[model samples]
Target: MRPKIYLYGDSITEESFGDGGWGASLSHHFSRTVDVVLRGYSGYNTRWALKVAERIFPPVESGGVPPLAVTVFFGANDACLPDRYSAFQNVPLHEYKQNLHSIISFFKKRWPEIVILLITPPPIDEDARLRHPYIENPSGLPERTNEAAGAYAQACISVAKECGCPVVDLWIKMQECPDWKQAYLSDGLHLTQAGNRIVFEEVVKKLKEQGISVENLPVDLPLIANIDPQDPLKAFQDY
Candidate 1:
């Protein structure tokens, strides 16, 4: 019997329209036809996900067939948000790390048998990092948001290690081949179609590593790649 798998993340995992999102793309890769539930939200932190899980996942009932897996990808927003002047507030790395630990513990306690996978957020562009007003802060902390990107990834791995769970390092992969203006939207956040495809491929590989078969999937970049959002496409091509 196929096991039920749940994916938890932010915007990158919420591509509802098609296979662009790893959540949707991975659904097609399972060899034994596993059930997948995409539990994704936008602008969420690990602390929020931990609280929300109690409300999102159904309660345990004997013979109800617990989910086989639950993967988590948070911390993008936890890097801190922009202030009134559009300056990055800069979340403390210690607090960010603690939030990760809390989420891991919450899920582990709830589903001890389920395989937990911790995913680190991808990298931030240097240009985007420099643009933030707080980047000019004299304290020298806000400027480290770019550096915190690495800190956040390491924190994910640290939490996973403490909990004995596997982790997927999306940070290095994205850095290896960042598409610059194309990979991210104007906000300097969120994944473009090409970017999401890369993440989906990694998720598939990780699933297989977890002993779940996710092979022979037809992966495609979203239409966001073909037609530039700036210029409108012809009637036949627009859809």
Candidate 2:
């Protein structure tokens, strides 16, 4: 069976395989070598994610084939302010940390051989988010702020360290790019084309550091160039 890479998170992950999305890039990178499965739910915070974790990622023993790696990306919605417009999605900082730990522990207990990569929420662009047409408060600022998201990002990093998992510090790395506000994020939360590339690169880098050799994974089938048109049966004869 082909190895699988599972992506679990919120809208950012839900849309990760969209046009120019990071997940899509990863899929293309692995191609026939791995199955990139996305389990992202829009607008979900870590609190909600924890409740549904088992439903989405069941024990490996109960499944057909175990995943090679799983990425737990959350915190954007958790960073929502506990105010009128965003309270519905708001999760306390302490709870957010706990939720992350629970998610890591769940996967570790179920599949100890699986590699877990934690991704922190990217920085928010309040100005762009406020200008977005669907923003909660058209006349006011956005429900999420850069500072608030940064706090959660830090917590995510801390969780990774405690859990001994690899991490993609999207929040910190994206900011290192020049004019990241315009280049990385779309509106305030989601990633743009450039942002997606950054995420894809970082994810691969982290996986590599953890001794997961993506480049060396076996291809799913023989190369087209190696197939002989004269003897198509020759390809299947071995099987």
| Highest-lDDT candidate | 2
Measured with C-alpha atoms, the lDDT of residue 195 in candidate 2 is 92
Q: For each candidate, how many residue pairs have backbone atoms clashing (under 3 Å)?
A: 0, 0
Please provide, for model 1 over 1-239, each residue's C-alpha lDDT reduced to its tens digit, 9 standing for 90 to 100.
35678888776565522536666666766534667888888656766676787898876677676777887887666665444222333455677778777777777788878888888877666455445432344442333244557778888888888888888887777777646444643234557667777777777777678876644322232234555567646423623
lDDT per residue (tens digit) for residues 62-127 in model 2 = 447778999999999999889837779999899999999998989988888899999999999998
Deviation in Å, model 1, residue 69 alpha carbon:
1.3
**What does candidate 2 score on TM?**
0.93
Task: State in Å the error of residue 162, model 2.
Answer: 0.5
Q: Estimate each model's TM-score.
A: 0.73, 0.93
